[model samples]
Target: MHPALLEIARLGLHALPRASAGALRRYLETARPRLDLPPGEEIELFAPGARAVLARAFADIHHWLGQVSGRVPFFADIAQIAVPRPIPELAAAAAALPLLRADAPGHLADEAALAFLDRLAL
Candidate 1:
């Protein structure tokens, strides 16, 4: 991971609600690949190009998260898990909502995910 991304992830942990932070830490610990190969061997599997692509995607997601952090009251829900939609689409939907109340329904996340899909087609 890029150093900047690592820093963002570290800082982001501090910003999360306690339960959400703990859940993310636990998930990272348990989701590690069980590769038996030596340290260098595992690193060799990923080409530099592939690593760059992954890093770009990670950065995009983090950027989108930052963009919506203040706007979405239930950001922790989306932050804790990866949404399937593209970041651009997610961002457009989030930007469309004038305000998302703290007590908003969980399904609003879904609605936001689809908000910009059609717009992107234009």
Candidate 2:
């Protein structure tokens, strides 16, 4: 990682209140695309039930923004994870606020679909 980005990840983001981190996480998710399928492939990828799960999550972004919130509990099931860096499954969810804020077409819909089982519990 770039020293500057690492430093900011530590100092810049860490300098803020806990609420800031929470808000930033939420905003990053909102910026991301809800799924990974191509525009025309949504039908093949997400069944009506699965799409509803994401719709609900999108509708409730403000209430559960962070990956850890369990509002979309499926996101928490990273295939593999360790300290500092997130697992590959959550790479997009790992984006920071500035990048996500500027991204017009973010990618993470697969993650949402993976979490659809949990959506029923919401």
Candidate 3:
């Protein structure tokens, strides 16, 4: 998370009433679709040369997930790739977490795999 953004989110977390499940649910329901555009819309809306559209889409999803849930659940849900933010650094960290304790060191050697991992670290 960007330092400035993280700080702002942290402040919001502290200010919000934790027991207000209705409020939280409403917020999330409204936020999710707004964050991720309708499928087939991104490329057409952004134009053919918008090479980074996927990255921006994912980032919004990541931000919304973080806001609705705490960090642990958010990251755990992200591990499944259900909500891809495509932020390089975040993608890198997410990719590594699953392998951190595994003995499968050979997997990271592939050039394409390495490049994918590198993005999560950004």
Candidate 4:
């Protein structure tokens, strides 16, 4: 488990399935500090080749996981290869989380997001 997941579990231990949207934000913020990743910045950088490398790697693992899914056995019982995300996306996502209000009315209460977030933290 990521440190953030553990923190989230500790945060919502009492609430369990009923943990609120604020918990999600707290989890994101908690996870953010340990990331040490560079912000993606949405292609704002001047460098072309290096930026492409970062963008392609980030997209391949996170945004475009589905495109690379079946080319190899994404469904296999064991993961033969593990692709890591670029530093930029990690930094960007963590930074952007604070801008969104976790207490907002439309937030989801699903645990699936927590699991996905945990993976993102990885």
C-alpha TM-score for every candidate: 0.23, 0.22, 0.19, 0.23
Q: Give each model's whole-structure lDDT.
A: 0.35, 0.34, 0.35, 0.41
Question: What's the distance in Å from true for residue 55, model 2?
Answer: 38
Among these predictions, the greatest lDDT belongs to 4
The weakest ten consecutive residues by lDDT in model 3 span 36-45
Backbone clash count for every predicted candidate, in the order shown: 0, 2, 9, 1
Span of 10 residues, lowest total lDDT, candidate 4: 77-86
Off by over 4 Å in 2: 1-13, 34-122
Ranking of candidates on lDDT, top first: 4, 3, 1, 2
How accurate locally is residue 42 in candidate 2, as Cα lDDT from 0 to 100? 15
* lDDT by residue (tens digit), candidate 1, 80-108: 23323222322332332222222123222
10 residues in a row with least lDDT, candidate 1: 35-44
Taking the tens digit of each residue's C-alpha lDDT, what string does model 2 give over 44-93? 22332554555555544534555456565444542221122322212322
TM-score of 2: 0.22
Q: After superposition, how far is residue 117 of candidate 4 from its true place, in Å?
A: 3.0
* lDDT (10s digit) by residue, model 4, range 10-104: 43444444454455645554544444434432313233356456545554465345455644433342231232333333344444433323422
Q: Candidate 1: which stretches are off by over 4 Å?
A: 1-9, 34-122
- Candidate 2 clashes: the total is 2
